[model samples]
Target chain A: MSLELRGLSRRFDNAQALRDIALQVDGGEFVALLGPSGSGKTTLLRILAGLDFPDQGEVRIDGQDMAQVPARHRRIGFVFQHYALFRHMTVFENVAFGLRVRPRASRPPEAEIAARVRRLLERMQIAELERRLPEQISGGQRQRVALARALAIEPRLLLLDEPFGALDAEVRKGLRHWLRALHVELGLTSLFVTHDQDEAMELADRVAVMQAGRIVQFDTPARILDQPANGFVAGFIGQAQRFAGRLTSQELIFEGLPLAPLPRALLLGEAAAGAGQGPAEAFVRTHEWQATPGPGNAVLRSARAAGGRVQAVFAVGPALIEAEIPPGLLEPGETCQLDPLTARVFLADTPFATG
Target chain B: MTPRPAIAEPRWARIVLCVLALVLLGLFLVLPLAAVFTEALRRGWGPVWQALSDPDAIAAIELTLLVAAIAVPVNTIGGVAGAWCIAKFDFPGRALLLALIELPFSVSPVISGLVWVLLFGAHGWFGPWLQAHDLQIVFALPGLVLATLFVTFPFVARTLIPLMQEQGRSAEEAAATLGASGWQTFFRVTLPEIRWALLSGVLLCNARAMGEFGAVSVVSGHVRGETNTMPLHIEILYNEYQFVGAFAVAALLALLALVTLAAKALLERGGPRGSLAA
Candidate 1:
């Protein structure tokens, strides 16, 4: 189902959880609500699932107002971060709960429920664990059971709140494919909430990057990586180091380092008409710079080969800048000049540059 | 993670503490319980059977069972409902309400019994109206049940609150989001989770209801056959110097307590011990 939120606002005594939040999800799209903790992404997901109500604003599912709908009737499946599976129930029983709870007239027969639960467990790759309780299974298996349980009701929209947050990394990577495949096979519109940017970037079709109860950017991961919406997004998205600089509409220059001036066009998304360059900051990732042999003030502190690339750190004056450059560029402690020509410096024009 | 050496302590001190604990328990608990059983059987089974089969003893037993039957379930319902309200929701005066639920625990049993008297006694607050209306509460079965209820009021709710709070309502919310109605969520997901704690609480509440004395004494008015519970019956027999009768009834009460404790222990075995410890 297509989902839309308009001007949603939720306030607690001391904090505004969500403020005038507006979001739209096209049918069958996998959208990630990416933000730091306390950013209201989870609150927004709860409101969408009818587990929580907004103080002000409308939640519409397929253009129908959900104001009068209760959570049980919404048919919007929600997977908790901790995988709130019934600890006492076996995997089979947990998955069948949604179907068995239906009204007598609508409830499936016992044989049908069993078959359906088995099929869902198999699809979750946990069919053999049907007889085991949740506590007996691994974290990843528990999450699969939780997902299978949520899906048993045939919900059109699935909401996962850090579904893999409780699992370790190796298991998390394996399960992401299962969720994406299920989303595609079921053609369900899924909204996933996570603070892990890599998880969001790897899984989401489009990510809604939020800060302080507002969506700062809503775009594909590639666009968000290349063109951050604001200073916050620029700092939040990539693991980029910050260097205070001045942009003069022609080129960018750093304060302490005597590096070559960067042309204006290299600072991607910073060329808004008349974007003044006084007291600005630039975000540069490790791979954005190149090292060419030269006798310069910058010293090549160390270089290491990693993942088929040369990962090295340079001591440029008092600051340490990491760069992923061409292999055999420079030996350790060698003087080399930085070539930020192919580098895409994410520039934040604002003075409050957190990056 | 490997085993470590125990903290070194003087062997004499450890032996002293262990002996002290055993001696204290033998003097205070094991000795008295054994005395009750031994004294009851000292006159042999013949007199003990006669004392147990006495009309007054039989009536007291019936009354005690009836009171527990009425009070246990009433308190169970109230306790579970109160616990659900306190643990599952936040509202104004929640702390105050919680404190009030535990009020009986803090207040003396006599005071709690006196409270009912003040509310329903013929010479108490509503006593005159109740007497004029020919409605008997104090010095009757209702009064006895009310006193027992007052003393055991906190058992189930106190047992449930900490556990419910810790387990949380996430599982219930998950069930609701999966299309289970509120009642369905409770019965299928929530009830099964808390069943062990509930059973443990019931055992304790039942044990207290059967053995309550101070509160029941304040309101029972010592009506020999009608109002006296098991403990009160034993008290009256002891006062009349009927050692055999009193000891027989005391042995029965002790057995009941032991049975309840065993049940509670079994329940603890089946679930987290900390849940029942609350």
Candidate 2:
């Protein structure tokens, strides 16, 4: 019941849309492909759905090769971002379309088809919209109809391409939760592509971060957030103020300050991190450092008014330096003193923080 | 609330411009129609009725209407298939095929008829083969129909191609993902979206087919009873010094064109609503 891609690649004339890549999803696993635009995430999903073929790769579902299988034969349900519900069809007809078009192998009797479609409509909570055309319904309702239409075929695998991208923020949030619950209830193997990090984080069992047609990190949401494989993943995962700095044996040296002194264990970890790591970088979660003024606190070297009367105050730390000030409290070109020791250190070349 | 003042403009100048435009329209577009009506009234209703009752004239008008009705749907089907091929499929010589489809529109109608004649005339290519098989074309009804078909083919296909291309491939692909078979996707999703454009294309094709004269005339050989179309009937009457009868026939065709136009509008309104309601 596992899906695997081996050496998948696709090229369009001068541009390589998908470089040689490989990935796997275990049975009933929900994996989200997260990437910026043109990173080839959607292309990979298309290949998996059999909508497009990779120039060089073998796609296997449950150990069965898909070389001879056309997209119609693959039995994979796909949900589109725009819903793509048949604008001319009522909700009931749309949900029934898949079943009605089924081949002899999986075709159900008319009564059974109707019952199945009704069940799916009930499941998606769109029975009331059964008679409504796609144009007559709201976007969210159309999306649900699209989902029901896809699910009615009883597909072995489900693929969703930015299913919530077109919706507003509030609808997106609710739909994400509903999709997660439905996935759990159905126990269906699913892969969805999304550019929104929050969507990937909140919905996927495993988030696969993509960049330049390659996966930078594939792990649980918390793991990827806490230990991003590279700077790109780190920056993509969460908000962290970073300062470029050099590493010392005992401390992170940045702006002439001994930032949070590294312990022996973390220093050893940093030393053994990678090759040519002299010009490494450090990052500090702004919420981690408390803002205070005292002689014991590090002196704020520079400050400027961020906006209106609010000020941004900068101070040096042991391993990293950051700015913090109350709104309209610190004026421009002012200095303040703050404490250090709450910063995390990482080798500049790589994105992994010193544990 | 206060009353607003009108914008400044010389009232006489506006009136004069409107009159000038009306005069231009009369000279260019209305005068000929007025002359046709006046000429028809010269012989009273007797010549008009006689022309309408003539077997040759009746056959010509019927054939024209029949050819238009048949050719329009054939072209509509061809248009949808051709549009889909150009929009969705990529194959070698696709551009050339598209160019060929549009060739009828740009090439001279006389040349188009001559080309068909060269292929099917008694002394032409395939002529002996068609004769041996007892198939009639070139100077026959079939030849007239074929010539009309050739010149009208591009009307529907051209109208539909750009619309289909602009829609992109997403909706159909999306339907495929939802487990719709090719036919279902076409009828339920693709056809519904393009129905309006399809109707418009059909109207254009029908209008062109009905009005076709140059290509049809060359191939029809003007066989008064068998091959003469409505336009040909009108021309024959005028050439025979039957001016009143010619104008009467012309008026009849004009009335048919008006009916077709009204039908087109009604179809456009009804077809789209039906598709949406489906």
Candidate 3:
């Protein structure tokens, strides 16, 4: 089933937890809600699961309005960071509980329930722990049981709130792959929330990058990493270092240092044309810079240095100037010539240092 | 050869500290109990059992345990529901409701008893209406139960509030998303998570109820064979100069308290054993 949320908002007494959030997931698609803590990614997931009701907006599942539906009636499966297994119940009983408690129309017979639970336990690779209470199992195994229980109901959608967050680094890596395979096997629409960039990139079909209660960019992982919507998205999604600069005609200047050629589209208006080059910023990949000697073509700036090695620095103008050099080629006081290969530029209205 | 070492504290300091500790312990806890037990045992063990086996005293013991059994569970449910409501829900007067629940803990047991008596006595507000319905409360079994319930109500609720507050709403919401109905979520997920804490609260409530003499005595009217509890029975023996019998009843109550304390320790040591998933 497809799921959609529009203009979802919630506010606590002290702070706004979520605001004007809108998103949709196609059937059988796996989406990751990626954001830092307090960014409202979990809040958004809870709203979709019907565990939380948004102060505004509506949730629709496969064309059915879910705003009025209770969480159980919505047929959504939510897996928590903490596995949340029923500690007092055996693994088998915990898995079977969801089905056993269903209304008569949806309830399976005792034999069928037992069979399903057994099959699921086997599928989850925890069959040996069927009779063992949750307290007897390890954290990772408990998470698997929680998943098996949630899947036992055959839900229309699945929501995972940092499912592997509680596990150690090694266990988290293993569960991510296992979850990907499970999603394929079940063919259900799923949304997993996490702040780990690598996990989101590896696990989701689409990565929705969120910051401060808003989705800054939502696209395939590769596209988001390669071409972010803005400097925030770029810095957030991947390892592109930023710098401060100003735009000139076909060039960006940083701290009185002229950078390499800028994209024609970026060089617009008075600021781009250098009328009020004013303040600007730029971002460049570390690999995008080249080392050279002397003021060569495309060289942005050259500074004085000691020893035989000179320190040359190039600016992408909208960003900062960076240099590439051989190991021990230039000491702290040495200088080298540099040039930038590509520049993603941003405008800053006031003069300031780049960090 | 070098000297081996000097102790952390001088020998005289150590001896003085130990004696001080012993003296404090004796004055606060050991002395009174020893005095009571020695005086009672001197009268011979025969009279102690005779007083304990007295039909009225026996009845009082039975009634006290019965009341505790009923009240503990009722308050357990009440405590959990109350804790959940205060922790997880927001509405007007919530703070006030919380304050009111804690009133029992701060209010003198005698005052608590007086409040119940004022409400259930013949000249009290609900007395005539209750009498009209042929329901007895004042100086009756229900009055004794009411007084005991009032004094012990805070035990479970107060114990549970902090625990419930510490355990957040994420787990319950997670259970709900897993297709568990509200009741199933509570029984399977929420209840199990809080089981040990709830049990401790219940035990504490039971212990307090057993020792709840002031409130119960005021409303029970100390009827010889009807409303008197174990504590009241002990009081009756002491008043009749049957010190040995009083100590016997007190010893039995102490044993119950010890059992409750031991169970509490075991449950606590278990330490949320099966509660974690990852």
Candidate 4:
């Protein structure tokens, strides 16, 4: 199903849970909603699944307005964060519930229902757990049972709310790969809500980064990383070192010291054109900053070999910057010159902050 | 290394507390139960059998069971609906609604019966219209059922609310998104999660309904073989100085209470898995 949302807004008492949210997902596409806690990503997913209704909005699934459709009639499959498997039921019975609850006129026979549940169990690799109660299985196995149960209904669209949020790191990595493969094999239109940026970037074809209640940026992982639209996206999506500087026609001045020349493309924007000389901020990824051995203003405070790279901290006056460098390239307490291989410059209202 | 001390408290204090508890149990619970059985059988098995077979006693037992049969199921349904409404949805005056449901629990049973009488008695609020419609509520089965319902109203709902609230709405939402209707979700997901609590509540309600004395006595006109429940019958027999007969019927009610306690203990021990078969 192709899903679209327009002007979605929801309020809980005095708090605005969602505000003027808009999004679109093409058929058979795997999209992910990524954000921190309380960012309204889960609320948006609930509205899409018809579990919640927006105060003012229109949700269209394949050209059909879902405003009047109840959740049962919407034919959307939802997997909960905690699995939510029925504790009293065996795995097979839990998966068969969707088919058995259908109206009698359209419901399949018992034999056919059993066959379909068995097939889904086999596909989810939980066939051996059919007779075991949910409490008798591991968390990962319970998750698979939940997925099989949701798939039994043959829904038009699938929604998952933090599907791997409760699992251990090792189990979560495996499930991410399995879920991506399943989405490809089934060719289902799936949208999953997650707070882990790595999981979203690894599994989704397109990622919608949400903050507060609105989608700040929606694009591929590479685009969102390489060309972030705002400061929030640039800081949130990856590690970046920010520095306050003054931009002029010749060079960018940091603390009255000329660091580098201003890029010509940055000077073409409306803000740059309106104020040719003003305070500006520059964001450079940790790996993009180089610490070359030389007599310079900056001193390398520390260097440690980690994750196949040397992570070194440098002190340049009051600001401390982190950079990833090749191992054994720089010693502790050595003076070096810092060079920015690539950076994004923006107009800042305040001084400077690094994270 | 030497072994650590095994006791948390001094040995004398533990012994004293244990003996004190045993003495209290014997004085309060065990003694009374033994007295009832002993007194009932003191006059020999013949009188015990005769008291049980008396037409009035038989009628009282039948009436008590009938009232339980009617009141228990009505309260169970109402309780489940009340819990579902209170726990699953948010609305204005929700706290007030819960307070109202718990109101009957805090009121005296006699006051509960009196309230019904004030509303449905001949000289009360709905009396004239009910009389015009040719209905008899007070001193009748309907009045008895109403009073019992009031006294036991909070059991099932009170048992279920905290449990249902803790379980939350995620499971129901999952069921709905999987194409199950509202009714299907309730029966398959919501009810199973609360089945054990519901059963425990119903058992308590049934036990109280069968043995209720204050409410039933006020509503039942003491009409022989007609309005008399088991407890009322026991009172009459005792007042008439038939000690053995009174103790015989009291023994039966005691057995019912014991059975209820046993059932509750079993259900609590098995916990959520107890109602899996249902």
Candidate 5:
């Protein structure tokens, strides 16, 4: 089902947890709420699930206002970050909990519940673990149980809070891919929260980038990568170095590096290209930049050849950033010409901008 | 072979600590318990059986059991509710409620009983109103039950709050999102999760309610076969020089304590699974 949120804000005593958040999710869509910790993405998910309430705003599922609905009545599934499985119950019982807890009039028969639970266990590929308690299963298997439990109620929207955050790196990759396939297989609309940018970019159809309790940008992963809303998104999403420079109507000049000013129109957009703004900053993703052995902008700290390709670490002033350098071009401690093929520069202060 | 850990305690220190702990347990626990049983049987099996069959002793046992039956379940329900409020939800005065639930622990047991007297005694706060209504409480079974309930009020709640807090509200939240109502989530999820700790709390509450002396004495009025609990009955028998009877009652209390300990340990070893378990 489609979900829409408008003007959602929640405050806990002195600190604001969420701020005027608004988003619309189409049915059967895979969305990612990508943000660092304490950015309020999880809080947003909780509010939508009716586990928490917004201090002021509206949440609608299929155009029904959700203010009066309780969490249990909302039928919005939530899988916790730590896999909140019932420790006392076996995997099958955990999956059966939702169905069994329904009111007597609507509750299914025991045989039906068992059949349904067994089917779900088989679908989760954890049929053998049905008799084992949550503690007996591996972390990955426990998450699968949690997911099956949430799905038992046939919820319209599934919300996962860092579902793979606790697993090892290799396991997290396999699970996310498997989860994505399951989402499509079941035609389930899911919104998962994660701080891992690569996970969001790799798994989500559209990512809502959040920072400091607000959604800064909501777009496709490629658009968010190519045209970030501000400097934070650009720096946060990709491997890059941040550098400040002066911008005149005709030329762009660096503050510390000895690089020549290029024409102003060369940057991404011409909307605010001819700038007369001072102290503008830009982030060039490592893949967007090329480096050669010559004195230009940045100093190469180290270069090593691995798997027949040279990868280098460059120092742009105090910060060290990595990029794939052309093979055999630069040595350690040598200055290089770091050229950004297509840079997006925003002026110092006409709009909301950052370093 | 796997290498030995570097952080293991030295052999001498470990041995000394273990010996010391065993010695302390024997001295403080085993000796006193053995003394009660030995003293009860000193006058032979006849006096011990006679003491056990005494009408006053039987009355005391009945009264103590009744008080525990009333107090333990009430306290368990109250404690679980209080712990649920303190652990699962945030509200105004939450910390204050937690501190207040522990008030019995800080207050002396005599004071806990005396407060009831101050409220229900003939000349105390609600005393006149109760008297006019032809109701008796301060020096009766109700008084004994109240005093025991007062002293043991914190057992279940104190045991549960920290465990519940450590277990967290996530499980309940998960159950709720799965379409479980409040009671369903609690009975199905929270209660089972905390069952071992809950059982221990009830066992402790029952023990204290049956064995309570200081508070029950203040409110009991020493009404022999009527209001006297097990501890009060033992005191009266000891003061009256009925050594065998007093020792017999003490042995029973000690047995109860041992049973509680055994049950507690058994529950822990075979407790519910997970690190977030009770």
Candidate 6:
């Protein structure tokens, strides 16, 4: 199913949970709604599943308006964050729920239901746990059973709200790869919500970065990393050091120091034209800034080895900027020149300001 | 091996608290229970059995069981519906509705029966109309059922609301997305999740319905063989100076109470599986 959401908005008392959001996922494509907590990603996913209705707008699946369709009629398989498996049911019974609950006219035979459940359990590698209650299995196994249960009905679209959110780090990592492979194998249109950027980037064909109540940017992971639409996307998708600076006469100034030449076309573009050239913010990822020993440069305040790499924190005026450096390149209290290899500069008045 | 941690309280303090609890239990619970059995069997098992097998006493026992059978199931269904509304849906006046459901528990049982009498008695609001229609509500079976129903109304709902609220709506929503209807979701997901709590509530309701004295007494008109419940019957026998008979019947009620207590404990210990066990 090709999912499309247009002009979606929801409000809870004084807070706007979702606002004028729009997104699209092609058939058999995997998309991730990526955001921090309370960013309206979960709300958007719920609206798609018909579990929640948007205050205003339309959800269309393959050109059919879903406003009048109830959740049961949507045929959208949803996996909750905590893997809401029935506590009393065994793994096989939980997986067979959707099939068994079907209206008798369309329901499959008993033998067929059993065969399908067995096949799914085997495919999910949880055949041994078929007779075990959900509480008797590991969290990871429960997650698989949840997925198998959702898949039992052969839904047209799969919606997962943090499918691996409750598992341990090691288990989450394994499931991420497994889910990616499963999406490919099943060829089902899927949309998953997650706050983890790494998981989104690794698993999704495209990532829709949400903030507050809107979709801020929607693009491939590579594009989202290399060419973040604004400062928020740049800082949110990766470890970025933000500099409160401004664009002055074709030069980017950081703390009254001219750091690099700003692209002339970008400065003259519509984004900067609205701000009227007062002040701007720049976001530079850890690897985007190059640091080398030099005179009259930012002083290195600290150095620590992290994840098989060296991370050095530099004190540039009152601001602290972190950069990834090679081992043994910089020591604490040493001076180093900082150069921006890449940066995303947005006007201070823009909503994309990280601060 | 690691050394065990010290107890939170001092040893002397723990012993004092334990002794105090045991003393209270003995003075109030054990003494009363022992007195009932000792006094009932004072005339031996022959009189005790004869008192229980008396026609009026037998009628009271049958009437108590019948009332419980009717009242418990009715309240169980009502309570489940009320809990489903209060727990699953958010609407205007939800708090007010919950307060209404619990109104009977807070009101005096005498007041509960009096309210029914006021509605259906001779000079009360609905009395003239009821008399004109030749329908008897007060001082009848309907009045007794109503009083019992009102008093036990909150038990099942009160037991379920907190539990269902804690479980939340995620599982039901997941079931809906998987193509289960509202009824199917309730039966397959919601019911199983709350089965033990529901059973516990039903047991409590049944116990209260069977043991109810104040409300049933007010509404029963003391009609010995026809309207009197077990508790009312025990009171009549005691007031008539039939000590052995009253104590025998009291022993039966006490046994029922114990059975209710045991069932409640069992249900609580073996309640729904913990959602986060794994």
The DockQ-based CAPRI class assigned to model 1 is high
Error of 3 at A4 (Å): 2.5
Give lDDT tens digits, candidate 4, residues B85-111. Answer: 999999998999999899988888899
Please, what are the lDDT tens digits per residue for candidate 5 over residues A2-43?
998888899988889998888999999999999999999998
Let me know the DockQ for model 5.
Answer: 0.90
Interface RMSD of each: 0.7, 1.5, 2.0, 0.9, 0.6, 0.7
What C-alpha RMSD does candidate 2 show over the true interface residues after superposing them? 1.5
Q: Native-vs-model 5 lDDT?
A: 0.86
Which candidate would rank higher by TM-score, 3 or 6?
6
Tens digits of per-residue lDDT for model 6, B85-197: 99999999999999999999898999989998989999899999999999999888899999999999999999899989998998898889888998899998999888888
Which candidate would rank higher by TM-score, 4 or 6? 6
TM-score, chain B, each candidate: 0.94, 0.86, 0.87, 0.93, 0.95, 0.95
Candidate 4 residue pairs in backbone clash: none
Q: Give the TM-score of candidate 3.
A: 0.82
Question: Which regions of candidate 2 are displaced past 4 Å?
Answer: A104-106, A241-276, A279-284, A288-333, A337-355, B1-38, B90-99, B118-136, B271-278
How badly does each model clash, as a count of residue pairs? 2, 10, 14, 0, 0, 0
Residue lDDT tens for model 2, A1-355? 6898878889977788887677888999999999999989998888888888888878989888884466777889989878767666788988888777767787888899888888898999888888888888888888898888888878889999999989989998899899999998998999999999988998999998988888777899998876666666765666567666676545555545634444323432323353334555555554445555444445555555555422344545453344545664444334444544344445665642211
Per-residue lDDT of A1-355 in model 1, one digit per residue for the tens?
7888888899988999998888888998999999999999999998888888889988888899894477999998899999889988999999999999899999999999999999999888889998998878988888989899999999979999998898888988988987888889989889999999999999999999988888878899999998776767877888777777777868878778877877776666554335665666677888788777888767888888998898889998888988897888789888987766533343453432221
Candidate models: Cα lDDT each: 0.87, 0.78, 0.77, 0.86, 0.86, 0.87
Off by over 4 Å in 4: A242-281, A293-301, A316-319, A333-335, A348-355, B1-14, B269-278
Compared with the true structure, the alpha-carbon lDDT of candidate 3 equals: 0.77
**Tens-digit per-residue lDDT, B213-254, candidate 5:** 999999999988898888999999999999998999888777
Off by over 4 Å in 6: A256-276, A306-309, A350-355, B266-278
After TM-score superposition, what is the CA distance of residue A247 in candidate 1 from its true location, in Å?
3.2
Docking class of 2: medium
- Tens digit of per-residue lDDT, candidate 3, span A1-355: 8887788788878888887777888999999999889889998888887877888888888877787677877878888888766656799988897787787887889999999999999999999999998778998999999899889988888888898888999998898899999899979789999999999999999998887777777889988876665566666665556766656655676454454555545532224433544456666665566666444333344444435533445443243454544444444433345555665665664322111
lDDT against true structure, model 6 = 0.87
lDDT of 1 by residue, B179-233 (tens): 8887888788878888898998999999999999999999999988888889999
